[model samples]
Target: MGQNTDRRALVRDRFDRAVGYEGAATMQRVAAQRLFEKLQERMEGRVPLRILELGCGTGFLTEKLRNAWPQADIVATDIAPHMLERAQQRVGEGLCYRIMDAGEPDVSGPFDIVCGNLVFQWLEHPQQAIARLGRLLSPGGILALSTLMDGTFQEWRTACAVEHEESGTPDYPSAASIGEWYPSLFNGGWETEACVQTFSNGRAFLRHLKETGASVPRAGYRPMQLSALRRSLARFDAQGSVVTWRLAYGCFQKPPRAGVFITGTDTGVGKTFVSACLVKAWEALYWKPLQSGLAEEAGDTPTILSLTHCAPEDCLPPAGAFQAPLSPEAAARAEGVTIDPASLALRMQEPERPMVVEGAGGLMVPATETLMMCDLAAQWGLPVVLVARSGLGTLNHTLLSLEALRQRGIAMAGVVLNGPLNPANRETITEKGKVRILAEIPFQADVSAQSVEGIAQTLPSWADVRGGA
Candidate 1:
């Protein structure tokens, strides 16, 4: 038999024997709760969605879904029949149960939402499963899941080195790999938030893995030699030996209704500031596709990197970086370089992952001879998050910007008012522009990490962006 076939049998047999799965699986249960909580916060006050949960092990998450959305149609499934039976017993009413594999699910769906908790690690081909789930979603539908990432169980691997080489944990994908994969698979907004959980001592970690029914290695069971265990124990820190579970949870859609495009009524209007805040808040990748001014510490990309501590790759290098602090066209001309709209139209490449793409200037700023920043945004098909000043003259600039965006058929995700508060301007812009004010950011005393986080909290719920339809 093939590796994947053997893995399937191993996974099934292990979970079938895990009768105390629920009692032992505390971390998985907690992570599932967190994933659902985020989904509720993101989808607050929206209509009840038809939800399909893959890998519904023993119904811990299924019960949570039932309580959260009693009116919504939910179907839960697992590869292990014994686990499915337990889930069926626990979730009882309002849920359809099945014994099916998530990697190659037998069910049919145009589901509003497809989610799975701690399930993707078992799949032989996670990319294929994600593509399958993408097809199952209705247009504007979301597919959310939590899965183990590449670095999970690092300490255990270190401790039991010999056994690990022979029979280690399943191969988990990296968060970066997942983020990169989405662009090719779906045309929608996606966001990945990563976290690490630490457990004291190797034994406790091993016990936790068993209780969660995640103890099965890809190659099947292999006992660690007692000598190996003793050697591993000697490596623990004074505090305790630690085991880490690296997890990535996220939400994405197939055909995006919206994406967050940060542009301001004018340059130096805190567009970069607001973009950084959104990047931190959503755990999104940052892109400044056309950086006109080239300065070491003054570029928008640098400012975002400083604010969010994002990886350098996550903050993409611009397609055109000119020396002059002028519009993309003028700057390109000054530097004896040509800027092409076709070259700048790279946002379409990865439609699935949620990203914060900062525009060069106001809506009508030109990227090329015929292509304005607004045109670029419309081409990308992302919603605009218009940044405006909150004081005098803002109403006019903001309204004019809004009109320009509307004329280009670009959707406005919302307006973010920057600087000192001016209730009158805010009210006038909201009333006249007919747009929602997502956030009214106060004057910041500093631009440190703590300050940025505090400011991010004030922004409207990210749910409002919803890949602007």
Candidate 2:
């Protein structure tokens, strides 16, 4: 048999054994819980929310959804007949199961919500599937999706590649790269949001993929020697056998209104500071679409509140906050938080005010395997105001940031230069760059309540610019 045929047969056989396959691990349960919460939020009050679950292997998620919303009309579809049968057996009335290929999923009616968890990677054409999914949504309906990114099985791929020449089989696409495929969702009539997350190491990681039936066949590739596999496993041992996974989660609304996005030149360059400034200046609602460090109450949101003197209710954090003081993916690994970008967007949509959103780190910082902060910005369709320092190399950082924003097609409101003014650098930033210097905040000896209050004086009247005046 051909490789494709053999692989399909293997997948079908695995589906047969996977019947009634409830996820056995606490982590898998936790992941399921997160996905459920996201779906609930998106479908809230939209009675009879028509939902379609693609690749519903073993119906674990379908059961969870049914329990959560008995009123929901869910169609659970899978390519594997055995998987569809298992799903039918598990789900009671109000749920429908069908055997269907995800790459070319065909179903009736415009669904209010289209969900595919850990399924996109297995398909031959994910982009086409996503576009088809978009078309499946009802007007104003949402598409909440989660997929394993390219970094999912890095160690295994590497080991297989070195030991076996054909071992480095193509894995799933990255969230960042995948974001490129659906620009119309953001740039045109749709409003989109996306995020990326990472896990610690290989065993736990592979197990999650297995439970979801997301494993790819290694046939036609160089066969892995047992010794090499053992050595690769050893490398993951130091990291507690934790394999990192990247998931791109996002929501796409059919039609979007005006929104705002915030970007920064580099970490510690004051994206949060400027976000807070804008919130205060505009009295806009505040949201940190993705937050990395949750330990420091003195971190992003707190800083914004301190600067703006806004009540705690004014600022909102993302769905998942990592305890580690690093990036979202890294912090999530340390804290055992499964970061899903679509889940974060659902959490962030609560606040109704003109929003002041603080991004984690700089523009390209990975929020998931396939997505970065800039992608999230573009998804929100926010006219961005870049935050940068007024020191040496500010010009370079600002220019690169602007270039990235331009590449992403994000509109720029202007730039905010923080810290003590370096005359030459500031001149270049304003004069040579030919970009508006929205504000110039002088360096403060102490970033205290008083210092923050003083700096607020230098801020331009954002109310005029931000349309809240």
Candidate 3:
């Protein structure tokens, strides 16, 4: 058998022998409780719901879910039959306990919710499992799960290194990896909240893992001798052993909402202003992935906040920044850094809530030597809301911008003309470009918060763009 198959068999045997597993899995229970609360927040009192519970070991999450929503139809699944046997004994009536692998879920679903706690860490390709789980959900359904991320066993890893060895803990996913995978896996937006937990001492931490049946070594991992382990434990710090678990609570909704990437014909063409107006109009959050001129200017974030009267939390910090006012690539080079355009990933928040994202400059602006600003938009899979001027030379710029987006296969949400209303230019761009004029913002003399709010109200709903309504 292959490594993953062998690992699965070993993990099943470990859990089968772990009698009284519930009492030893304190951390898992705590994580499950938090996940349940998040599920409640997402459901918002909707009843007669259908739920699919992954890795329902010893009924830890199943029992809690049953208690919370008695009327909800639930299917509780686990890879280990022994674990499912215990879960069945604990929760006899409300749920269907099945022996199922979460990574390759075989059960039928169109479920309103699919939840798993401390489960993804064991899967060989968690990103694939997550994508599969997403497919099982009904339209507008929610996928909420808590998984162990990288940097989990920091102290243990350090101690092992001191003894010229490796820690036996399973390799977990990292935050950076999750940030990259989320965009590709879920076309709909998603968000993550991270939590950390600590233990008393090295031995106690190891004991917790063993009693909870999670201490199974990785595929092909060799066990260290007792003497070597003792020597490694001796290196534990004075403040007690620390196991830093990075738990990412990810929430994604199905029938995905469309996200709009707001780009302009040129820099300083009111992209931020348009973004702020959209935020005010739709109550959507604003994010700028790359900010190049932060050291010299207040930047887009402050401008968005001031113009929208939105709270500080409404705007996310730029993913990459530099001191120079030049293009992102040039600024990064000036600062002795190479910008990896693929490295800039968006941080999602409640998928149901819409968001307006602003790009650094024009559609063809270089983010890196090999990537342009439009490439980032395409990567995000969001429709483009082309922001253009309403004056002379507008038609050529607008047409070229639209064509660039089309070549990249990025969907056009619609176009917004930001300056004085030009009947002829607007008609020409819409007619020739073959895209609707979603809105035309009359040139504002004051450009105050109130004026921005009024303009926001004049804009069409983002749903019209997303739903192609």
Candidate 4:
């Protein structure tokens, strides 16, 4: 009992003393971003209504979670009160902050997601804590984490070995052992990223570790004598030392739920129009994960609410809102940022009320440098409701989009067409694409709630659409 308390105290003190942690914590920030992206593989189409984060030191990871899901109720906790204070300062308002440890997390449950970054290595019993975290999840919820793993700090270890001294770096779990940490009932998986950081010399390297609160070794680790420490430092500097931080990204899912992704055959293809019709028709919730042109036009959230007359709360805000009237990738780059489509993943809130997720641009459009709109839709695991124009070259555009969706194995929630009804175009699309048309409505001179309701009346019931999907 005394040893456990001492370990906890030492860990807390280490972080509490790290006053300049934010600037020096490059590894932590990178791990947080990668962890955020990695989590989407396990949890697609699930919007977490509630999220609990452990060890949110200085809020680097906390800030990412908040930006990705601004609508979620996130609670960020840490072992050190000083660190929690810094986190609140970094993330500002709208998040719940607490001074709590991940080893013995104290909070309510049924959260859609529970996560931590670089916290498990400090736990007294990491595997047991993971099982406890699993118990806190809602049925279909996930517990995601990124931790420092074994084989870290190889350069420092080698230098110490050459100098006949003990290395201060803590021993971490192997990838295979981390795999065994998941409970028998939970479905869990992990992958690793090798991040390299080069320092001018051994002294600067030690300073970086101290500033980031990662200098603390294991409970029983012994410090080297002054002579030995100096010899090891000289050896490290002579070897042109480079530090390696192996981040193990792990996610454990309880189960999963559902949602629908709305995309277009091409840009300006009535995606918002069909999305609003669905929202008004099914009385569903609305979410547009990526929104560009905010500087020039009225955002989709307001448009959906105005047309559907749904409660403002029913329409969750976009994960990313960029200023330029350009593609998501272009706009994000303009603002010195990049959009990750995986950041759009969400756990379903109310199973009864469906969510209409509208995408920016068409299937082949890029959300990031590597992630296409079709790729995002597939990662979300939502059956897609493709929106298209009713005439002209829609035959080619619609068929191409359908082929892309099919290639990714994304389920079809059918199609909705805009503009004047062209029976020939509709027939050709359905016949060639082998897909159903859910609705075909005339072009609206002025879109309003009444018009949206009228279009809704023409569409089939949610059950019918869902069954076909």
Candidate 5:
């Protein structure tokens, strides 16, 4: 407990000097620019757009926000007084810097925008912070923010765990859970958008966190010993200092919103099967924007239709299907077919029924030269259901896939575990892996037509399978 306080204080002291910190300024500037661009695009010509930033740190983001909206009134708040002092020094006019905790933001008024960068993990009650932000925002106002996700510091965590079993900690919350925290946001009339970004290594990565004043420990969290920390750092060095972080960014718009986008784990994990089941249960139309590795006639759309008993006319294929059993890009190239994601989306768009579209391969798999499956999922904006094979090795794969989807800001509708059940694997995946296995489909010799009927009979209802959807 004492250590936690000291660590927090040390972080506060480090960040107090962060505004004047050198070397890392360039990276911080670049990140700040990207964030500013996103906020600027959202703000448009709204005169004097009111902007509120939680945990403004040394004011890097706050300064960027001020520059982007010189006419806007920006209020930057942080729990660390020294950090707030530095932030005040950085931003003179149109920006107000205050020392305030995000969990209990003591600012006034319904702002046009609430923005924060890499600050959510330190809070004990992020959902409450989000709800407070929601209450603070004016009608139609949006909350644009970014934070360190579960995969962040994975290398460091692993290294620490070997020497000190209890030292390493669990990853941060999934973006889906973060989204689900505010059920009222969706059903109570609000539109939300979220995504995650992954970073490559530890020294430079940790340095970035410090520079941005985002390295503060949680309020009541314990700290590891110095010897263990040194050993962990040494291990990271031995491993070529490979480090990674997952950052989730999101924006929630108040009222009068459209729909949400959905994405899942990797390919052949039953995304299509579960999507078909969802469609049948909801009486929704089913669509597959792009189908790759089609066995001439045995395509994903057909398989889904057969499973759901949808009409043949409802089974839409890709704009250009290829015979080669390769990735969509490679397959299209082999078949000399132009693969346009937009064209494929246009071909699959249905005006009636809640459309369930299946993606090809994993989130990061390239569809075209420039687009990935995740890019398409983000573009479409549907609530996603990730399908994972129900067995060993799924824990890592599911977590990684969830991390990928989170980074892309895709809304996941929970996970569906297909294939036979393995008790050990399921326990590890759900407990240690921190993923909810919504449903488990036992292994069977045939997922084919002859046995699909039997499979359907055993299959649980969509809502029940999806854990009440």
Candidate 6:
């Protein structure tokens, strides 16, 4: 907590000194313009959007938003007071201007759109921050932002590498990782572009960063000596270097309606059964995004079909089905098939009935090299129903799963405890994890359709699910 506070202080101090941001923010301006255009495309036909803009440095993007949608109730905010003041001076009144962290917005939400420009990279926990922001959006609302990505400043990085010196540039996340940050219920993706900016020499590049207040290095980095820095600068200048700014523009939207994303503490936990109960209870659509282990056993979807007696059309096809009995990522690789997470992110169209999405394995299990089962849940923007065994080690596993979901700000419908009843385990999870005990399904000698129907009757209503939805 102290470290995070110190880091935020460092960022605030740096940006406070960046009085020249308006003049020096070339790439920032370009990104703001493009971000606005992209947002315009997404928001077409939707009027009077309740827009909340994060890190509105000097009002570059805020101005565009204002001019673009005068009807919008624009709430432009920043962490630095100077930047907020500068933005107020640029765009003047009507739009609410506040000095606050994007991770902790003081304003109420259900905002039609939440946006930012060239500011996401500065967040300490970009993933967690995005999840928190997603909570602020209205139904069908979007969180749009552009940020510096991993490949940015490669020229300077190469120069530093050649000079055997450290570079001050913070390591940015890749587009794939950024995509994973969004809540599973939200249909989110990023598009990348490399915008090149030329500077006279290495000193100029360093100065440019300072002018834009982007000089904050990653925490715990040792600064190079003046001599070493000068040498690296020389190397950078000698290389015919023009810096490449790898930018990723992302858009994540809260669905107008969604259901629960069912996952488990472990692979063998009763997620399939819990999902079956929910589908049967709500008469909802079921989608198993990635199915593995065809070689070993029948997948969850078929079992769900038989258990729920759901129509074939109600069972949404698996986005990626693999023959190997492994994690989705590993299974895809073994089968020589590339699965795009964006391709897998399908929400029901005008969902009249709820949809239950069942994930294979545990939350941390990798769906891809860059995405986890949890990331898919966050992306889909549905409230999660974390199922766990109700005995012995269940306490730790259930708490961990709850914490993971809380950290991502993924809405939770609650935990469904399965197996032999452990009142102590149930009490501990409810008290320690601060999660509702959605259901307690005891062991059944014959787990059949009749039993499932009885259990489904005990589950919460659609309104309960939508409460978190």
Q: Which stretches of model 2 miss by more than 4 angstroms?
A: 1-10, 23-28, 43-45, 157-170, 181-183, 186-212, 226-240, 256-469
Candidate 2 CA-lDDT value: 0.64
Whole-model alpha-carbon lDDT for candidate 5: 0.62
| lDDT by candidate, in order shown | 0.75, 0.64, 0.78, 0.83, 0.62, 0.84
Off by over 4 Å in 3: 1-3, 181-201, 237-239, 256-469
- Span of 10 residues, lowest total lDDT, candidate 6: 179-188
Instruction: Put the candidates in TM-score order, highest first.
Output: 6, 3, 4, 1, 5, 2
- Per-residue CA lDDT of model 3 for 29-78, tens digit only, reads 87888788877776667663789999888888898888888888999988
lDDT for position 429 in model 1: 89
Q: Which numbered prediction scores highest in TM-score against the true structure?
A: 6
Each model's Cα RMSD: 19.1, 15.0, 16.1, 14.6, 11.0, 10.6
How many residue pairs clash in each candidate at the backbone level? 10, 14, 0, 5, 17, 13
Candidate 3 backbone clash number? 0
Better of 3 and 5 by TM-score: 3
Candidate 6 lDDT by residue in tens digits, 274-372 = 888999999889999999999987888898888889889888889989999999999999878788877876566547578898998999999987999
- Which lDDT tens digits does candidate 2 get at residues 334-423? 777667767655233433345766778888888775678888876665567788999877888898887777666565667888888677
How far out, in Å, is residue 51 in model 1? 1.1
Give per-model TM-scores: 0.54, 0.49, 0.57, 0.56, 0.51, 0.62
Residues 1-469 of candidate 5: C-alpha lDDT, one tens digit per residue: 2124555466556667565453455444444556666666655556446888887766778877777678878888876787777678778755677777676777886788887776666655777677777778764466776665666666667787777633334347675665554412222111233332333444565666667555655445577787767777677677777655565555654432222233455656766666665555555566666667776558877777777787766666556566777778888888787686668553333442345667777778777878887777655545456778877677788888777765665555566787876787777767764455656776656555545555555544544532311
The model with the greater TM-score, 2 or 6, is 6
Better of 2 and 3 by TM-score: 3
Please provide, for model 4 over 55-119, each residue's C-alpha lDDT reduced to its tens digit, 9 standing for 90 to 100: 99999889888888899999999989999999999899998999887878778987999999999
